[model samples]
Target: MARFTLLGTATIPGKGTELRLLQRNDEFSIKIAGSTGELMNSRLHGSEDALATLACERISELPSPRVLIGGLGMGFTLAAALKSLGSDAQVTVAELVPEVESWNRGPLGGAAGYPLEDPRARVHIGDVVELIRQSPAAFDAILLDVDNGPEGLTRKENDWLYTSAGIHAAQAALTPDGVLAYWSAGQDPAFTERLKRAGLSVEPVTVRAHRPGKGARHVIWLAW
Candidate 1:
């Protein structure tokens, strides 16, 4: 067995929370302090890639499609989105934690092929919810993988993103037939109902953590 070594720790603003980064041989993993579960693992990111591919694939033919991706956990999601997008397409990735961005551009970049360097990809170092509240009908698709799910384990502020109000903001930010996708470690029945109550169609997809369809199952909610 490869022993895990603590590489470093980064502070997550506003909650006095610090995320732990661990390295085991060539792999990297991140987790919140005192949490049993890992926030993200470099080796397992099929669902994250699916989050972007599934959303962008639907709007591929649309000219200059704009996408808003929340959480830069790793660049896997962004990389997948960029692959499916056209030349004129734009993808805005909003990451609340600055260190997370650095991690992507630094150690984690090698794993996902440095997506931030893509001209079509832009990184915003702030809360994604704020961006949603500020921009109306600005995106063709909104993808979020913040925390573990709608119910946050990293930051309580993230709770707003899943509430009826946040859903309204995301819905308003999207263009006609625009899709709002959320990635969660598990299922949230109440969140599904909330999406329906907001007048949007929801498709719940279960995907594997690893590509050839292996590893743990995760839920991705694609609402339009």
Candidate 2:
């Protein structure tokens, strides 16, 4: 593998943590400034796509479905959701870091086919919790891929999303038959029970990080 070249860095608004963008050949990676692990890589997004695909499939028949995505990451989830949705569908992406959105608009855009450019896609630069709180039975599907997983790696605040309160908020934000999907690096039986306690039916699906039957195994929890 070739050495990675630093592209840019941005500090997470309230958290004050820095995120670095690096590129090696045609591939791109985003990592926390002091962390050794990559937060997102353009080459691996199978689970990210699954997060949206699994959620979208449930609401595909709705005449004008509305979807909410918690994190943009490399835009893989957003791209996959747009691909699965009909023209009348609208997808709102809530991205905490503005630079991540910018990266996707720039060179990182091509990695996911520039889903943000789609007319049906909307960008919200703020905490996804705020969006869920304000919305009441508004979305047909809500996909969360923020901060790695339920345990969280980048932000401590992300832990709230996995808590019972957060689960209820997500539940209230969904339509009667809406779906909520979460992306995780690994599975958590506790989180599965948490969703059930919040009155949702949970289905945990394992997916590959790179391609089918290849790469790391990740998890996607579909709740309705």
Candidate 3:
């Protein structure tokens, strides 16, 4: 085993929270120095990839399907979306912290197969809420993995995305049969009801974080 090496840090806008990049024996991880500890570990992203795979499969029928990925943590979700979608599909990834995209281009690229370099993938270095706000039925699927769960951690404003208004915005941004998927460290029954109230058919799925029933079980809500 090797000790974790601190690589770089990025500050979350408005909230002022910091995200630290760490490396250890070829493994990389992103830790949020917020009240809630470690954010994501590169070695474990099975559920993250599932977030995209589960949603994309339902919407793959569309030609040139457009996807909006809320967060770009370690690029696992983006990489999986690119791998699963068709050649003409477009995946838009919005990452609030620019350094997260840089880390994906630098040390963490290989972990997710350098998805940022893919031609179909578009990277936006801004708040995903803005993208959702601007879009109106512009996407076939929206994958959200910004925080540990529906609740906000890294940024206070993220709470809006999970609220009724945010849910409405996400629904408005989606096509008629579009899918909305969320990756959470755990489950939230209230959130499920909210999705239903937003006029979406909700399907709550529980997936093992490390596959093969290895790590903790994570919940992904696939709403349409």
Predicted structure with the largest lDDT when compared to the true one = 2
- Regions more than 4 Å wrong, model 2: none
**Candidate 3 has which clashing residue pairs, if any?**
none
Mind sharing the TM-score for model 2? 0.98
lDDT of 1 by residue, 164-204 (tens): 99999999999996899999998889999999999999999
For residue 126, what is the lDDT in candidate 2?
97
TM-score of each: 0.96, 0.98, 0.97
In angstroms, the error of model 1 at 189 is 1.5
Query: Which lDDT tens digits does candidate 2 get at residues 1-224?
Result: 69999998989887899999999998999999988898989999999999999999999999899999999988999999999999999999999998988998999898899999999999999999999999999999999998879998888999999999999999999999899999999979999999998888889999999989988999999999
TM-score of 1: 0.96
lDDT of 3 by residue, 45-73 (tens): 88998999999999898988999999999
Model 1: pairs clashing at backbone N, Cα or C within 3 Å:
none
Cα RMSDs of all predictions? 1.2, 0.8, 1.2
lDDT of 3 at 113: 85
Worst 10 residues of 1 by lDDT: 99-108
